[model samples]
Target: MKQRLNLNLVISMSCYSSLYKPSLFHTTTNADIKAYLVGKLQTCKDLTSATLTHSKAIISGLSYDTFTTNHLINCYLRLLRIDHAHKLFDQMSQRNVVSWTSLMAGYVSHGQPIVALRLFHQMQASLVLPNEFTFATLINACSILANIDIGRRFHALIEIMGFGCNLVVCSSLIDMYGKCNLVDEARLIFDSMCIRNVVSWTSMITTYAQNAIGHYALQLFREFNHLRLDKPNHFMLCSVISACASLGKLGSGKITHGVVIRRGHDANDVIATTLVDMYAKCGCVHYSTKVFRRIQNPSVIPYTSMIVGAAKYGLGTLSLQLFEEMVDRRIKPNDVTFVGALHACSHSGLVDKGLEILDSMNVKYGVMPDAKHYTCIADMLGRVGRIEEAYQLAKSVQVERDGYALLWGTLLSASRLHGRVDIAVEASKRLIESNQQVAGAYVTLSNTYALAGDWENAHNLRSEMKRTGIQKEPGSSWIEIKESTYLFHAGDISNCNQRSEMLSLLRELEERMKEKGYVGGTTGVVFLDVEEEAKVEIMSLHSEKLALAFGLINTPKGVTIRIMKNLRMCRDCHETFKLISDIVERDFIVRDVNRFHHFNNGLCTCGDFW
Candidate 1:
């Protein structure tokens, strides 16, 4: 109260009489002096400069000037001195909307979004209405919070306040809805906009990309290009690259790389990190390495992406090598970084190394193991035929239901592979009764029963799944040839333009494979009471095989074929790829739900463990 009352007299030179003095000033020079102080406060790039200018402002009696005070608050915020900024804010005698909004933004930026929300309530109580920037900052706070209920309330408030069409607020709403996984709601906001800029497009595209709807993201990007609204900015390009990685569109990914180079965004570390992940997900880890190597100063993100990428293709040594190098560089590894290291250890049969990394995660790096890291550890144990140990670890992880199901699912997958039906049953049973109802565990357990000739159990599990409305995710495989993606599903070529030729090529490959002692793995087939011949035929037409056939027919011999599958590659397909690779003298890379398998010369990079 005292500070607020004193602010009025601050401009009166009589009040500043330290011991006895009041000084006279020229009106033009005094105004010029105040304006110059405000400008210096506005432009202070660091705390030292900002504090120095602030001292000068106080000596010049500009500290209590509302305009100058607002600039100082913003400067302190830019320097991340949120405490100082808020102190100044509370001391302000008169605060306009800019004053409130700037402080709220600082809170949001500093990750104190609840504090920002409280500030909003106080601002409203003060009869200060929010502007577009204020709404934008609040909406961003909701995004970080990921509270859709509160976010929806903000959306309603924006509409109530007639800010529905404001570009900045609308863009923030799109981002908020996207983070909440309400894609259609976000798209509705985007479509209703009268005009859209690069920020709007990037927000919408990022929403689609991050939500696993990459096809829609690609469609949006194509539309953006058709309209030629603006050159795709860094964030927009990064999202598109991520979409390409998900779809395994190497050719389109290459074109995106060209754009990156053309726009000189190739050197940006953030974009480089995204590109590293993109290439790694697209079944091109070597290309990921090339992009990662170009970054002179490596951060945790790029190194983690590189490590996880190498692990995906069973390049465990390289992944661990990168991990050691990262630690030696004094770059602290985050939880995700440790996940990558453990994942590398699991996939490459480095069980001992993986255990070491897991033990050191908390002790050495101070990274507490999360569900993902624990999942990797379970996978490592399961892969080495330690099914009981893996099962016990999964049961002991102390995670939520979803994470519990995930760990058990991994154990079930390993059990099915290792002929441990007892472990699979317990894991599946626990998963079914758990709060998180998932389809993978049920399907894997059913498949295990079928493989072991326990058809009754398989039928019962499927019936239970159907009764509960649990649907197995339909499996699909994609292969890109000449910039166009071709998709296939099990025993289905309904979408293929060259179905006849592809089928003939598949038949020929089977004949050649059979000639080389390759037996159709009908025992691994999940069909109930099916004839052997029928099961063999079904196995021959699996999605990945169809994709591989298409790739072989289209690409030249020895051109490494890449296939992306939405589910884990079955044991039969894994075996078939190994034989077909040697018989046809071509290499194949298949990225399935779990990991990458590189097949060459009658061997898979996974060494048949996967």
Candidate 2:
């Protein structure tokens, strides 16, 4: 009886075990767990909480593989949990190239390029070879840091590792070189490439344009047009158009605009903004306004560009209107936008409006005024003979080194204009103390002394400059005609072919001006001992006048003559251009280093204020 009972018990146990076997064996594998965690990390909206929870769960439940750990690090980075990511990275039992690259990228994305570079060096020390992505990320870091030597080291490594042909790597190299101001090296790399893409072309084009080699930029764009590969994108169009604008090549600019329209990129925000800027800088405010109006929902950049364009051409009222409209549209103005508004106020002699805007910058818009904004306000005040207010305003700002220098420089210029010898001396002192290398301050002070009839002091300052080897920059001007640019320096008689005709045209214009009751102003020349007649003669051969003459003689009748000068327009030149505009029955547009001067009908857009 006992043996029979035991057999039945054993038989019952066996039956129960077999019945529940499939359910008991249904457990998740490591791979399945990793996939589930990855999905949660990727799709989670609240990445901070979800990522933290999932990462902890991952740590507790399973031994994470390299792939799983990399994903977790990436998730932490996305959540901006750099500390947690670094901890996990350090705790990893075995790290691969992906592991190192993941953390390096995290550092870069967080704006810690230096930390990223350190991680790269650490990875190199650990003997883990970086992949293409690693190399690309490190190259970007180098670009941001502007560490050209470090970038070259990596380039050498890439070449030795046979990864130079990788398109992404090559593109990054081009960008790195470009940012380092090594455009020629960038071009060499570009030319040597077996394959090219849109990004590579854009990088080279932008480099040339930004480095003041706009002509080269245009030539590159022409070459890029012949390539049957990718079509020019909005970025490329913006860069090339900016190049045209800088060179004052309106013809080339129009051609680029046609390309933009043909490619259906005219509506792109960057393209539209750049087009507005291009037209404005090239002295075609009408075209600029047209382009700006075409945009459906313009942003701050476009609005600011339009405002600045209006101000550049002396349309201050329009600029103010645009500013008000932009505010009404609920768009927040940035620092640059305010600068444009301030510049408009200054040019229009709107002292109250400019002051209101300056006050509102911090109170209403939360945009703190920087050195440039302060400089504009000071300049405006100084222009209207409010020297005390301008001085106080500049002195009130606790600006950086460069900003302080700029403020003082503006004050110095204003003093020179208004014949405030005491203020000019103080400003000159401050400027020299702050930036001893600036030649403008010394020259301005000398000129101020000469204006005050203190010729001895002026001569002493001139002697000091000469003793110190502080040579002032010679003024130069350029005018573009039919795709060719003619350059002239102060007292330049280099172009013998056009010298006689230019001088003759200038003399005729002078005669016409004299008949219209325009007397030559001797204030512009700084040669204290020279006779008044010689001063007038020397002033007549100023670079801007020569360029204006060249433009008038070469261009068609009734066309506006545009000249670009490397320095501020002198008082005499300003008066001469106004008279010439009326006598020639044409507009004279001069873009000096400071601002634009539009002379028409015996009046200047600056309202005789600039």
Candidate 3:
């Protein structure tokens, strides 16, 4: 009732505003009236003020003026009164490119990309040549949709329409390609630009960082500094830090952290959240916790990052504590927050807790459960040897047809781990039937057969894979030694110049390992039909083991050796490292494709569960 009364008073004042200043209105020209309306619209910070000012404009006969009406539309959008903005736009007698572009941009910002696209088509059909802003806005819409086809269409249009050099358009193009996973094309655009701004540089770097091309991202950051471009802002710093995280480059991450501190961006929410994730990913969760604690009032993202970090480190209890803290503080959890929570349960073997959270996702948290949540739950079940339940849960996931690929792959992986040949075959069949060319699924099944000593089946599977052109992605790992990264593939030491020293050190470690009861498992030797001794030798040369050997010899005794791998660490290497850690009494951090394993004193942070 009070709200209605205040609104009625505003209406009365708006209707009688001219009467209150009759002499001024009589003396003022239409231009003066239009200017006054535009000024009012510019300062309209709230819906009530905007509506009052809008009514005054209508009363003063300036509603028909395009410039003033455009201001009104913009002001209405600023006040989040989209209905009023669209109604005003529709009623406009003269619609310019700005009018269409403004409405389209509003829709895009409001997460309605399809509406923005429709408006763009309508704008084109109405014969209004889109300005740079229009092209940039629609390109952003394309990026949000991650639709490369539409992005390409806009790229061609921008080129033909002579907007290719426009900074805004070029940056949007780079971002669109990045979002579409066309990192190479994004780099092409970034390289060809005759003029580059901070936004473009950030976009290109962000593209590399997002795509796991962290080394390239660091290279770009170095060039960005060499060119003496604008100083790196929080956005660019966040991207560089993310690159460090992806590569698990603690040295680089520390340097970037220094930059964050010097620039006083440590307090910035986005940068702080990114720092949490970066430290966590770089195998430094203590730093992550410190940053998380320093946040004045942490949001869902920061909490989620910390939770995910804990989950990765097998600190499931801590993850749940942070989650409860967030809820107690009245910070609502988003879908990603729930994902991190579920990951905590999955990683820590909290099966009952995971199921409870999954069940409460929609009912208690108001966040709907999707295939992603189901994947975590299924993993939690699978980790505990509930293979059938996991498979059934994976089957029950209802999502986009393509989403089944992850489900199938998960089931296949779990089945392979538990030696469930029947379920592994079933998962592989589903993969084939769904036409999901997941090379990893076939590789897992083939490895499963080999592990079962069914060499004939394994050989046949390999033949089938060759016939289908589904080659498994080769596994590789790299370690950063004294700021230089050295990569190694299975049994391949040709790429490193210090291969002999690395081999010598590896042989010594193996001798010490055997003395410490480390008879290497032959489980990872699936592709070969070699003798057990030969298999142990083959396992010793796996990429991650080679990287570890290199790190152990090169780094100082007290320093933590960090290595990053492109695939999950094999069980033999996992066990070998546990023993090597005990023998050497040094900390070794291995960031694999799955999770980080910190081996210290014959114990892994994963507690041997992972």
Candidate 4:
């Protein structure tokens, strides 16, 4: 097709012998010139920069009608030369709605959504009423800004102009609301829509997934499937697979993968990458690797996903190997790739390697360290008992207040782990001064006091937290079995039917763990003046342990148990999981808030580093 277009372009340019003679060009009709230019603009590939430049030279001397000018503007926009398009738009003697919309769309395409919005207001002030496309573009701008107020205003105008029912406008509104973190509002608009298309459905699915309502997204996808109004496309499948990954639903993800295969989209790069991510997040690294290897000449997305997945599973060596391979293949590492590599290093206790990567990121890859990158480096340093170095690094780096607070919090956690009370105090003070409402700082400080045998100070801190109306977030864990997920909170006994059995199994495991020299660590329990036995009991009822016990009772002996936690695993729980894995001879994979911990034969992949 491109060859044919190029041949036509050459033929058309040759026929324009009048280019050398203005008198002959003046004889040509405006309508005929406009028709020819518009055809070329529509057919020529945007990446063919040389051809576009030649076309631009040819059109420079010709008189253009509004129709031809609009085509030229659109052509420049498609080529991502927004400056050229804007200049052309400004030089036009007369403008119409098409002219204004063309420039606005150009701004939006060029990642200047704010500029696009400003131009939209200017167009409205000029009394050139926006068409449906104009409204759609403005709504998308609102979505990018994530401004709910502006989006509502656009929605009002859309309804006032009777374009609320237009499929494109409605879809944009849904997307805008979703990006604003108003998924309920997005859903309301979706439900109210009288007409829907594939794009609309996909937008709503993506909205739910983006808002962390993955289960709802999957449910909506199921409803869309039941309707059978349209077949699922690659975009829809990708969104659904992402939702499954978020919920760690391996069964549903596999079903979706099967659908992708049946639809012959398994080879598509995007779908393949999504599949790899889904399987990896679901604790099936083998399957993720299998999907990744099937792609021929895989791009950075799949490679980065695989690296991050390996890191999540505590396969740091494997992640590093993949990074080296990617470099050997001459696929330049992006910021995300470096992040995965550093994360893998941190999880595996490769502090020196992580530092080297951090130092070379800007020099070797031309990727500067962002806040996330710095945080990974701080975590790596802190993991290996280098709290002072981590703290100094955090202080030296220029980051936003939130990033600084996060770094301090990590330092505090490391101090607590390594019994560095002085450093913990310093980090806690800095964190509190920066952000008074950070509940983690208060909790960690109180725990630090408890660990130091200062029960009175710990109690006072707890009282202070109550007085300040600050409450720490509750820990929760979930496990999936037979396509169903069961959630448990810390010390929760809500499941009356299974609570007794779970508790009995936990007790049996506790005895076995005790026999294997697994003594409970009481530092995690913050209660003052608690007996040692009571503290052990309290620690045994942690959410992850409950999930683990449930998995042990229900799953076959040989099957691996996977648990996902909403917070960092406590020391007691981590040790217990290691012992349990050895006793039951079943591998345990726990995905905490930070990273993955694989327990096997009384050992963890983190090597007691995390």
Q: Which candidate achieves the best TM-score against the true structure?
A: 3
What TM-score does structure 2 among the candidates reach?
Answer: 0.76
The backbone clash count of each candidate, in order, is 0, 0, 0, 0
Model 4 residue runs over 4 Å out of place are 1-30, 46-62, 495-497, 504-610
| Per-model CA lDDT versus the true structure | 0.70, 0.69, 0.71, 0.69
Cα lDDT tens digits, model 2, 496-592, are: 2555554555667657656666555443433322112112111232332323233212222212122234212222343454554564455434332
Compared with the true structure, the alpha-carbon lDDT of candidate 3 equals: 0.71
Per lDDT, the best of the predicted structures is 3
- Candidate 1, residues 177-258: lDDT per residue as tens digits? 8888888999999999998899999999988877767778889999999998789988899989987776666667788889
lDDT for residue 332 in candidate 2, whole number 0-100? 94
TM-score of each: 0.82, 0.76, 0.83, 0.82
For model 1, the local distance difference test gives 0.70
The number of residue pairs in model 2 that clash at the backbone is 0
Give model 1's TM-score versus the native structure.
0.82
Instruction: Identify the runs in model 3 with alpha carbons over 4 angstroms from their true place.
Output: 1-28, 490-610
Kindly report which residue pairs in candidate 3 clash with one another.
Answer: none
What is the lDDT for 374 in model 3? 74
